[model samples]
Target: MSTHRIRFLAALAGLLLLGAGGNAAAQSTITCESRNGQYQSCSANTSGGVTLSRQLSSQGCWQGDTWGYDRNRVWVTRGCRAEFRVGGASSSNNTGAKVAGALVLGAIVAAAVANNKHNDHDDRYDNDYDNGYGGGYGNGREIRCESTSGRYTTCGYVDRHQHVEIRRQLSNQQCVYGRNWGVDGRQLWVDDGCRAVFVVY
Candidate 1:
């Protein structure tokens, strides 16, 4: 080949290599850990950046740092857990294992917290339920209903709302309500009169 033609081919090859390197650099894996470092979870192979949130309810409680990943700070509650998300690239290498580890770690942490609370006789932390309804309430609108008599009360749902649902009961009195709660697309009803906080997902 002529010298000019050879130079052109070499430049093309270099460009291709550079492109490949760029792709590789853009790839990244996502991992999650409880604030206390008692639990760690990682996502499948992914590129770019990952967004993580704490598992909602009993799975674990975590709050993400307001800042970006560089300043990532996860505030874990007594029963804290973590979640990971892969971004950019799509690969599931060893993801199942990572996820399983995360779940196991979460269970361990939750159990530890429960045991501690039980020993301490902490009524405030007791009776908390995690319905496995997913992450925080998100941007959904909040609807609240209060009952003073601890009697069954209903918090009717509004229209145009859909998805997962969760309820929180707050009471100043040390009363326990039976598990006679029910939820529909439009409303949530509690059989007892406890201040109910409902979030429609």
Candidate 2:
């Protein structure tokens, strides 16, 4: 009800917005996997499926571990494994187990949301790239082409389903988005839709 209190609330709201924005701007993500079973070896695999052999050292109050991998199974060789002794739960309330379970669930949800957002952004980029050069426009059924300096540029003559092309422009690099590929060859800008997608060499 007071002016001072109102200002304090406003400042708190701004800080919360700033924190969310900072988190959204982070382009990196965290991925974690834990498995306990009959494993012969251990390794950490990236989300892209590449495996890393180096053991990750745990920080904070957590225990450290090493891992190994075998033909069929990946194993955690040295790490903390929580096991419940027989009749122990009846004697103890298992407070530590409950807290650890909550933490693990939180981590899983965070990872899932981050991964979804990253994939959504990538898809949007692909859509924009497709829409920008998909079809022809203007008075001609075909896309308009013009020579700029030495290279040629193409523009759509109509909306939707129109295609454009450029020639003689030097494209030293190629960009790949989702299943879509853009070729910046020495010729002109070529929009091949999702076909002819370039892969990282």
Q: What is candidate 2's local distance difference test score?
A: 0.31
Angstrom error of the Cα, residue 200, model 2: value is: 51
lDDT of 1 by residue, 1-201 (tens): 344654554555455444444533343333344443232333344334555543533443322211123223222322344454444542345344445555544555555556563566533212222332222335554557666566766776543224323456565543222233444334555554556566655
**What TM-score does structure 1 among the candidates reach?**
0.26
**TM-score to native of every candidate shown:** 0.26, 0.15
Task: Find the 10 residues in a row with the least total lDDT in model 1.
Answer: 62-71
lDDT of each: 0.43, 0.31
Task: Evaluate model 2: give its TM-score.
Answer: 0.15
In candidate 2, stretches whose alpha carbon ends up further than 4 angstroms from where it belongs are 1-25, 37-201
